[model samples]
Target: MKACISRWASEPFRVFFPLGMLAAIAGVMMWPLLYTGKLGFYPGEAHSRVMIEGFMGAFVIGFLGTAFPRLTGNASWSCGELVWMILLWATTVASALNGQVLVADTVFATLLLLLSSGMIGRWACGNRDTPPPGFVMALAGILGGALAAGLLAWNQKYPLGFTSYQFAKLWLNQGFLLLPLMGIAPYLLPRFFGMESGHSFHDSPTPPPGWWPRFTASVICALLIAAGFALEAFGWSLVGHVLRATVILAWFASETPVFRRGKLSCTPGNVARFAVVALILGTAAAGLWPLARVGSLHLFFAAGLGLAVLAVATRVVLGHGGRHDLLVGRIVWLRIAAGLLVLAAATRMTSDFVPAVRVSHHIYAAWIWAAGGSVWLIFVSRYLGRGEEEPS
Candidate 1:
């Protein structure tokens, strides 16, 4: 038991990926329970909090905790740090489950602080390499999350006005997740498509000349996205959404081959493309049709960020488990899971637009999302503990 725990600690994803999926399942199940009268209170805020802070938060921490050390040539997370993170994360989920939104957000803020402090320490001392230029967005993301979490906690105590509340939500949901995804994609996604990433981590103390241009562009995009959020908070919803979508599209066009042919032929690549499209479409739809903001954002949440997380997690698991052969070919389970997520997103949107079947479709969408998460977990859990030296 001691040895097993130690081994799992060596790679944070081994523990947190599974935890993330479970949180996702728990989050979606809230709706069903509420409709069936099993739950006493409305689950709107709790559900969103759990899905975003608990589900997505777990994956972010797991990925960064594992990858950050490698990117900077620093030591992996200490056992103490891992223990504290898990405790805090688990507490956040539990508090959210009990509808203690303030408590959950406060704990989540602490977790982000801990994570950021470790990464900053690595960057400031005893690091042999610099992370890619795009990681500036990642830094922005964590700081944004911490700020949003703090605001949310404060709002629970002393109600924030409508604009302030919406601003916090925007920061927590879109800004926190989207920034990191866009930042990391340029550095990581190429590897999934069997192409060399130009921003791959190296042991150089200083970045190459070519790195600065991309770095400046990423910083600019990140700022624009934040400004867009501010615009939305100030009631310029349409302008904000359009600006965000345009910036996202332009950034991807410049940094990735997302719009190009031949690169996204593989299952993971296709899913990656779908994720980006969902994000752009969702952002635009929320602006063009403000009445359907709830449904439109699901495309960004359930399909965009959710599927991207699964695709990247799958690659990480397979690669680290010595199953590189499976990374390219049509992995039937992953394809099915991705299809289900798309279906869920559509079903959820339909619930918002078609009032006749709103309740039923909302429940159906939740179940579909849960089903997709289960499928992913069932397949990927197989690779979690396998030694990297093991044969495929």
Candidate 2:
């Protein structure tokens, strides 16, 4: 079994992480989608988040495990990669479909899959890119993230308490996002098309806060998220607010500049660029976090952060896969899933969101989440089956 994982380190792991994140997102959208107000068969929103996050971790670990090495032209996974991917995905899907992520299920979910995936990912993220620091940063971030995930899972020996929720949120926010952004964004930012960063716009060797500051903030953010979950769940709303404020401030301060620094913008001509408005809306929402009512924070996160992810992923797939496809015939999606996400976010924010007299909310959420995922999957399937890597 050890030898098996060692051998097949690269591809399956890489593919799984993003796929898992997609699952978590889907589960969230599925619940609360009933016009009839009947909860979907998916886990309630809270459990759904962690369960899906587990799925995301599964893929990320898999990807980082091998891709890290591959970036430096070092090598690929040793073995057992497929087994890990299948088991994890199967369990996650089962958990999600069940509608309740119990302690036992969470334990099982971590045991047979998430934990193992992290270990493998850590093994793969051994090398660093030579000419640039992007690969190195990504490698380090992924390894750190994997370690964090393992620790979070390990800490889950108890019931689904507040601490576990914080850990779960950290896994998504920090392990899944912060680390990857710290590591890969620099690389992906430039070589977006899987090609050279031709104009030399974002050309850089070191990343933000001179590495140390970035690391400090990332670690702090993780801790704060964990603390916030614990405090909030325990009814310590004041502490939770304080922790969230700190984390959010750090997150924005650290991250917002990266986008601003570069002259390179998301191609306005690129249909993907439409996500910018969504991001702006999200940023605005975040800026107003304390004031907003119930679903506002979610709107910003989904529209700004999550929606941007959809646009970016779809664009990346098209560009990398050599497609360059655009919107769903004509309308916008969550950032864009089905055109429904736009409406969904609006509805979430306003509740009275337009006269959606009949259609269920979950359908819109599912379509939005599934849309980009489906497109990405289609591209991957085609890419894997057809021929060579995307042309350089």
Best by TM-score: 1
Q: State the C-alpha lDDT per candidate.
A: 0.88, 0.45
- Candidate 1: residue pairs that collide: none
Give the alpha carbon lDDT tens digit for every residue of 1-392 in model 2. 55434433445533554556556555554554544466554344434444334544454455455444554445554455456555655564655455534432454445434444544354445423332333333444444444444554455564355555555544444344434443444344443323343212232223322444445544555555556645655656555655655554455334433333334333311222333345344434443553442345445444444544544444433443455443223323322342334555655555323335324544554445445555445434443321125452
**Top lDDT model:** 1
Tell me the tens digit of each residue's lDDT in model 1 across 1-392: 77766766667988999999999999999988998999988988899989989999999998888888888888887788889999999999999998999999999999999988888899889658888989889888998898899999999889999988888889998888899888998898887766667666456777766788888988999999999999999999999999999999998877776777644367787888899999899999989989989999999899999889988899888888998888776999999999999999999988888889998988999999999999999999999989789866
lDDT value for candidate 1?
0.88
Regions of candidate 1 where Cα sits further than 4 Å from its true position: none
Distance from true location, Cα of 307 in model 2, Å: 2.9
